[model samples]
Target: MEVLERLFNVALVVATLRTTAPILLVALGGSFTTKAGIFNIGLEGQMLVGAFFAVIGTIFTGSPWIGVLCGVAAALVLAFVFALLVVTFKANEVVVGLALNILAGGMTVSLLKAIFGTRGSIFGHGLVGLPVLRLPNARDLGWFGQMISGYTPLVYVAFILVPVLILFYNRSRLGLYIRVVGEKPEAAEALGISIARIRYVSSLLCGLLAGLAGAHLSLGYTTMFTENMSSGRGFMAVAILIFSNGDPLKILLGCLLFGFSDALSLRLQTFGISSYLVLAVPYLVALIALFALSYRARPRIIQETLASMGRALSVKPNAATDAEKAVTRG
Candidate 1:
């Protein structure tokens, strides 16, 4: 009972919100690419590059906001490269994305060593983290204040983007174009919509959001950049994208679920649980949730597959009958 009480508390909720921010940002970015029918797996690499650059920018400019711009800029460069290769050159997106991830990891570590002279991590007195936003008079509300106040600005931005993106996808012209391109590229092209341009825009948007997520991690979540500090949140964002089916509202829910498991893992560590077990909690929850979702959708998938096969078979018989009739007429 004590364990349950400790696990379920206002503090836990706050931590969950903090942890959810980065994942939410990245997932939201991935949603743009997903809507454009682009399968970008390089979100992890983009995020890592952003985090590293954000720290470097902060050290040089003495400002976290500048650091965020640096981070976004770096991610955008990477995103541009991704678009050039995958969209313009017709390269396989999966292969390019994986290569970029590898490149980002190695490049960050090498840069860390060369620039900062640090091997595994870089943190010192010169780093500037983001400021927390304290709501006026919210503290008077007790537990409510704890839940609603004292978060970095990016956290608020991440949550606010949910509704903003939903509106964009549902009501905006560009959003409709992205959806049309993804669903029917040929038709979009026939309508004079440039598929390549839409894809490039989507990729860049993904990079921008990924950059923000990384900046939040280094500047807000913690004022340091460890080697590979993104810690698979990019991939987690991809998973969230898949689980949410690119819906902004469902994406928010998925991020919260992941954040809750992550926060719960940290909380469990304080209760004398095995560190390994606690560390595995978030991934385990993700896997179980994915499995459950797949299982629930299995019947529908099978039905669709069977229907397609039946249609194919029906087409062949009709073709044979037509051929036979033509021969008889001749």
Candidate 2:
């Protein structure tokens, strides 16, 4: 009972929310590109660049807000480059995205050396992180307070973006245009909607969102910048985007699921499990969940084929065809 209670503690819930914020932001960003019929695989790279620049910005300006802006600006630059390559030049999106990821990583590291004279990590003195919002008298509210209070401003923003995105996708004209372009490019072009322009805008929006996630990582969660600090959360966001299939509400649920897994992994470490195993727990759960989701969404043909195979293996072959039996009798 105690173990179970500990596993489901209020602190765990708070941790889950914290973990979800960055993933939610990035997933929301990825949704734009996903819906625009483009795959932006460089989210991880965009996030890294944002995280590094965010730290630099904070150190120079002594303001977390400026850091956030810098992060967004950095991401936008990369997004523009991506747009120029994949949308304008018609380069292979997958290849360009992978190359961008590599470039982001290398560039950030090199910039870190030049700017801070450090390789792996840099911490600024008096570095300020994003301020947390606390509900007044939250303790009296019990579970609700524990679950909702004391989060950074970005948490609230991320949650709010879900409904906003839903409205944007369903009600807004631009959203409709994006969908039309994505679903039927030739039709959209016939209507005189520039497919390349739409794609560019989508990529830019994705980059901006990714930048916010990176800002939260470097300035909201931690006051230091580390090499590859965005880690795989950006990739996880991409996975969430895939799972949600561009539905903003579904993206929220996916973020929560991944966030809960992350929080659980941290909680398990307190039970004296190997740190390495604990570190792998969230990813392991993610992999299993992704596999389960894929299995559940198996194509009708595949399921029918498997069912036919099972029937074939379970029962004997037809004793004889009707024509064969009649001929034998004759």
The candidate maximizing TM-score is 1
Clashing pairs for predicted structure model 2, backbone only: none
Model 2, residue 29: C-alpha shift (Å): 0.1
Q: Give per-residue CA lDDT, model 1, range 79-134, as digits (tens).
A: 99999999999999999999999999999999999997879988985998999999
Candidate 1, residue 92: lDDT: 97
TM-score of each: 0.93, 0.89
Off by over 4 Å in 1: 308-330
Return the lDDT, model 2, position 17. 89
Ten contiguous residues minimizing lDDT sum, candidate 2: 314-323
lDDT per residue for candidate 2 within 28-143, as digits (tens), equals 99999999998888899888888888888888899999989999999999999998999889999889988999999999999989977879988856678999889899989989
- lDDT of each prediction vs. the true structure? 0.94, 0.88
